[model samples]
Target: MGSEKPSLLKGTVDAVKACPREIFNFWLFFCTAVWSFSGVAKGFDEGNIASIVVMKSFKTRFVLDHETDDQYANTKGWIVAMATAGAVFGCLACVNLVQRLGRKNTLLVFTLVYIAGIFGQTFSSGSLSGLYASRFIAGLGIGTTTVIPSIYLTEIAPRSIRGLITLQYACCQQLGVVFGFFFNYGITKHNAGTQLQWQLPTALQLIPAVIWGVGLLFTPESPRYLLSKNKRTEALKVLCDLRNLPEDHPYIQEEFAGIEWQLNAEIEAVSGASVWDLTKETFTVTENRRRFVLMFLCHMFGQWSGANAITQYSPTIFGYLGIAGEESRFLATGLYGIVKFVSVLIFSIFIIDFIGRRRSLITGICLQIVTLTYVGAYLGVTNKMSTADIEASSSATAASKASIVAIFLHAVAWSIGWFSIPYLVSAEVFPIRIRSLNVSILMAFHWAFYFGCSRAMPSLLAATHRFGAFAFFASICTCSLIYVFFALPETAGRSLESMDRLFERPWYTVRQVAYPTAADLADGGLGDVERKITDEDLNKVTEVRIESQTSKNH
Candidate 1:
């Protein structure tokens, strides 16, 4: 009876240790999806149509009320630009803070900042100073949200579904954009008062921000951050919780050990022991520098792809398509947002791995080139020709509708390609220690370009015709595509440890990491022949080396 009891207890322990890894992954996915929704809220409202629409409302609510004598009319653009400026500061501040405070707490701070900003918006008087302050405060929140979510998601998610989870962050941002447009439109359609129309949209964002703050308070810190802090037991607990496995499970043990091994291995190269040093790659190892440069290039390429301009000025772009009236423009913007959300959601689920990162990015850029070229041609021809000729050649409605379609297609290409790739890459490629700082700088460029492209668009569109503006964007896409082809690595299905191994080789370039098709995942796939390290057996060499040394000594 005693022997039987021991056997039964052992069996139960083994079963607990064998919880499916996929369940942990799914839980991480769920948590990430929830956290992501908050980050997207600001973009949906501030970056897309909401800011512009609110500015336009200032004309009726404040400018005319002051008898047009006040310069509040002229200050609307500055008010709108204020958020971007605040974001710049917020982004820079986060670089040090994210690592110092930790991912979960840093994110919670952002939600609070956002909630405070939203509360301020309710009291805004449409004065130049008031609007500027509010926008700047909101911008800080926006900047923090943009960069922190990527850092958190990357740290917590598994390698197998990293791209999907990272891209899910991007997708949620787009979905938020769509919701903001609808919310603004719905609010205005019922009552166009400043309080109802503009204030409500800004205020509504706080609901999600509050929810995120509370949720993150209860959430575990990144296991990587835990390890970096030398809280090994806590790190293991996080890993087990995040992986949905018992602490004793073999694969869980392997991942935890691998993370520890890499951290210890790198620390051995460094003289000091501090989290700040870790964030800076203070040891100056080759793998560390490679990861830093890759993230830098990924962000540089992400911005150069014209993604921000599309996101920040979709309504304006639709207006350039010749849609007159505010409602018409907002409707078009709504449709563009919807297409972006759907495209990202679809690709992340079905094609992120299959299409591979490099190919999808190139495909996206190529599509942008094609669509922008056609739109530019049409606009250029119309501008150069006589009004009579344009009218005779095509109806205004037809031309406008065609332009909208082209822009929508451009959004579609981006959501699947450039829009999601940078965040995905930033999250996946870096070492755990420096993930936050790296993603912060990367998204800084992203938001910086976002601010630049957005702030510049109104004036640029005024100066250059639609054809000229789009031509510049098309040119950017061309250069970015070429760069991505040469620089981006595939990273599909590669474990974090295996990816580190690639960095160890010293001879590989970005092209080597591009995604292979379904054929690659097949039994005889080219990738298998080229790089066939099994996920379960990566650290076998360490054991082999130890055994061989023992045999020789004996």
Candidate 2:
């Protein structure tokens, strides 16, 4: 029996050693998807609200029937924009709670909070104020959920497929959006004038939150977080389990050492630093500041890409495009949601790592610019023709069809590049010590920008008309393309621990830096990078200390 046990153990080890990279990566991806369910909850709200806003039952319940068209539009914008405002507060609040409670626990707490918000919305009646408050509460949960999952996924994912794994956040979010749209469509079709039309769709938000909270019990806490808390033995064991390797394995050893080295360097630099001091260092350090700027711009431009304007007001946009009838508009919106979901899935799974980050972003933005501009021109001509009393002309119908096609094309292009890249890049850009803080701040800015766009879009449309509104969005896309071309680095396959070296250069003069191969990782290639980063960080700490002492003496 003893002899047989030894032989079995040896065979199992050999089999693990011979396992293919693709199989291993797929397992990791599966694990990532389980944690990314929080995104689905947020996406559900995003898609559901947009659809609900156009429902006759929703407007009637809110007493929008007594309001003018302008008042109705403004009220609708406020309802949709309130969630983003809540998200900004949630993200800012998470900066402290995530670090204190740890990522997994914090997520659980937020999930409960989200459930409360959903209950409020599901049962809301009589007053729009109650609905607004409920949406804001949901937004808080979404904000924390959005930031935490990306951080967890980034920390756990293998370097070779980190981008692909992180992009799942976007994929799951779009999936949630698809579910929301279809759920609303079905409810609207059957329960059009009943309160159930909006109430049922609102209630569906609980499903993803419940699933995510239950799954959190089984999921492991992040190994990197363990290391940060000085639990080295626990960190190592978790790393081994995650990688499906033994403690003595070369990859396991290198990754653990890299984490320890980076953590040590951060401690040395900010040994006695307070939260305020770390915040200062985030801006004062050249590399950190550069990354901050890049992340912020990526997120800011992503919101301004006109996606919210189209997505949040899809029924309205379709109405403007001459698509008649409520049922047709809702069906079109559902189809639009599906196209977005599929396009993002395809790009995240098949093309993200293949094309590299910088090129993909630029190319995607360029396509957005073209599509938006074409849609604008068509709308401009059609609007002028309508004013001239040629309402049923063939050219008007043809232009309307072309504009709809352009909108679908825009979704495809946005999904491939702009939709997910900003979040992926933000998650990958920061160091372990300040990652939570940095990402929280960045996402807060993101939600703030989202709120701005969502709030102002209705007004912008009112002022600019359909054609001018698209032109404005096209102009933003153009600016975004130029900024990405010059500022964003290629971060597709790089190790998270290597971010210091990755951003060491000036932002303008960039080159493609490939990730270390298996052989390179095993042979201590990353060790050399870690050492350089350590030396530089320590030197900066020394210089700062000396300057501080001198000033004190003076």
TM-scores, all candidates, are 0.75, 0.82
> Candidate 1 overall Cα lDDT vs. reference?
0.66
lDDT of 2 by residue, 1-554 (tens): 22111222343355557653433654465568778877898678878888888777888888888887777778888998988899899888888887788888898888888899899888878578998999899888988887889879878876544555677787888888888888888888888899998999889889888888898887888888888887879988877777878889778887787776666666665567788877988899988988898888888899999986688888788777777666788788889989999988777666665665777788889889988998888877776554234346777777788888888889888987778787767756776556656877877898899999998887777778668889999999998887777667765335545556657777664444434333222223243224334446867656765776799999
Give the distance in Å from residue 192's predicted Cα in candidate 1 to where it truly belongs: 3.3
Model 2 alpha-carbon miss at residue 297, Å = 2.7
State in Å the error of residue 335, model 2. Answer: 1.7
Residue lDDT tens for model 1, 1-554: 22111222343345445656454556676578677776676556554334444345655644534433234323434555667777888888887887799988887786677677767766667554666677688789888887778767877765544545666677777778787776666766665654566777667777767777777776788898899897989999988888888899887887787676555444433425465677657238787777766666666556655656566666656655666556666666677778877887787666655556777888888998998887887777676554455446666647756877888888878877877777667656665446545666666777776666656655554456657777887888887777677656676545555567656644346466454334333232222212333333335445554776799999
Question: Whose lDDT is greatest here?
Answer: 2
Cα lDDT of all candidates, in order?
0.66, 0.77
Clashes of 2: 0
Measured on C-alpha atoms, candidate 2 has an lDDT of: 0.77
Worst 10 residues of 2 by lDDT: 1-10
